[model samples]
Target: MGAGTGPDGSSRSDEEWERFLRESMAGAADAPKEPSARARDVAKRLRMDPARGAEGWRSYTPARPKRRTGWYVAGLLALLTLLVVALAPGRTVDLFAGDDRDSAPLAGETARPTQAPPAEEAQRPTAQEPFRGSPAARWASGAAGITVPKARAVGWMSTAEVERALARSRDFLVASSLDRGVLRGERPEKAIALINPHQRDVQDLLKTAFRTPGEKSDPLLLFSRFRPSQARLVGSVVKTRGRLTYQEGERGALQVTADVTFVYPVTRADAGGGDEIVRTIIRRELVMSWDDPDKVITKPGTFSIVSYKYTMTNGGCGAPTGYFTPPFGADRRADETDREIDPYDRSGPVGGGGSGGDECARATRS
Candidate 1:
């Protein structure tokens, strides 16, 4: 950044504070060694008393100068001044003279972080006030090329801070996504443990999963019309991972998310009353929001997973809808309405088309 003027602050309105920050940031890259000092000088020049005029910092000399020092003392003092000037970088007195969290008072007192009125407290906008930063709009295509609106950190968000937030976001996502093994084993407890205990959603999912654990039934799943046989189907399933990314949210929250592909080979009885081999694929985007995060994500990340799945219905083939697409994966074969497939046909993105898949299927059934 280079030195530049900001929004007209000559009027010194509350809005001026933001302008000052804009100016400060404009020259931030080439900032002087003494940034605090530079800030003070800028503030002083802008009028530590923006609301006041000449009465603010008028200077008054004593009635008469006292012959306090002799020439010998004067010479030493001058020499000392020269040495200090040569040795030190530009130095200025504290402008704010107040505690941390940046802000300068416009009333000639010391600068300080401004407190918000009761009405504005909910957002908890930062002390920067005028410089709470700007909004950044971004969008990403999730599981089915469906664009999800998201945000990017802008303004005061240092590159380091953004990266730090994103990394933690990713940590939460990868750790929180559903694990096929856990699901297949009917270890709902294990799946629930992956989520952050702080989230209400985790508790809700847990209550539902364990509502009647010993009975080999899940009323919630049954209520939602999810098949009990789906559990058995997952026992022999395969899943693939896709892209991972992060997005900023309101009040500086960051969200990390991933796209995963789940595949299940099924032996559903066809409407024709004949046995047919079918494969079902679901693409799910798992998201976890990190409103607060550790500076470093050294521990396994945890957050409730929010999921979205996209599978198109098009083919006349009555084949189950599939989700995985090319790049991270390929879409399952789509043209087959009611066509019978070989029990070991592994030609699709998933299922037992290859020899290894055939063997796995045989072993799974056995």
Candidate 2:
């Protein structure tokens, strides 16, 4: 049998067989090497799907992430602004400027605190008029300035009980502050009587302060006094301005708060009639409470002092003399650089608790 011959008896050469196999299976002469023209177009369309695809079926392309530089810059600016505000020094708001209870000076208010006269008025008090250049010139005289709020029932206390408590508070303020004798180093008996006896702790402390008036236990914390030998009062009048407010306590007590500012004028005891007068400004804030008569063991008309604080400007920082010694003559030290606060500026309450704030801080004006 020949290798290229079929069983039917036809015969062919090896070359013919090889050529036939190559031509039949390889391809036609016009066939493309890569793809048909239409197939090429389909491949191009698939590649361009990223740029211009139909809605949902083509390759998905996520949008570029939004830039965060602008948001970061805004956050940083806000933080810097907050830090600047926090580091700034604090300022006090005026406490007395908007007091509606005692807005204007009462009628027939003649007495006032005194100071060295301005260029227009004589430099000394001449028995007729004393308030020369005092900032308290417009303030009311003594207890007349302490205006009590209208009493009404609060918590467990009735209207009448509230009124009584208010009256007692006003009287105590007058006795401790406005009484000439008390100011001239006399005992504040009336003020003491108002204190509830059950407040043994306060009573004991008060007694100790009065008995041993020293740097730590000075009675001046509770009452204002001036040494008679050191200085003489300029006149009979002392200017005062303040208001009283009441509220219900958490423990069913009537809490009364008093904020008052007093101005006193004095001269050196041995100075001539024409000598200059100096002033002392004292501001006191005290809270007194009256407990329910039946529920608490309290006296019928007594007050329990909750807290007391004061600020005394222009009162010399002298030794514990139990008196407000206005730096007079050569006694006033020359180093008053940090003592430029205003006495009458009732911006905030006396800062320090218990014993009033910094002593001897002189004011810009008295």
> Each model's TM-score, in the order given?
0.31, 0.63
The residue ranges of model 1 lying beyond 4 angstroms of the native Cα positions read 1-180, 212-241, 267-276, 293-300, 304-366
Clashing pairs in 1: 96-111, 105-111, 317-336, 317-337, 325-329, 345-353, 346-352, 346-353
Candidate No. with top lDDT: 2
TM-score for predicted model 2 compared with the true structure = 0.63
Which candidate achieves the best TM-score against the true structure?
2
Residues 1-366, candidate 2, lDDT per residue (tens digit)?
Answer: 434876687887778888878987988787768887876776688687755445434357789998999899999999986776677522111233442222344443222324332323224443344555554665788888777888999878889989988998989999998888998889899888888888877888777877776666687777888888877788898888778888998578999998888888877777563476777778888999888877777788888889887777657675666677777666665424474766676545554422333455656666
Instruction: Kindly report which residue pairs in candidate 2 clash with one another.
Output: none
lDDT per residue (tens digit) for residues 1-366 in model 1: 234434573344556667777888778666667557765665687575576444324456458867857987989989987777677633312322433212321221111113311111122222122111111001111122222223456333455655664555443332223333332333444434556676664456456444443112222221111133322231222322244556664345455554433333333222342232333433344565555444422224444445432221111112111111111112123332342432211222222121111111211110
* TM-score of candidate 1 versus the correct structure, residues matched by position: 0.31
Total backbone clashes of candidate 2, pairs 3 or more residues apart or in separate chains: 0
- The lDDT of model 1 is 0.35
RMSD of 1: 36.6
How many clashes show up per model?
A: 8, 0
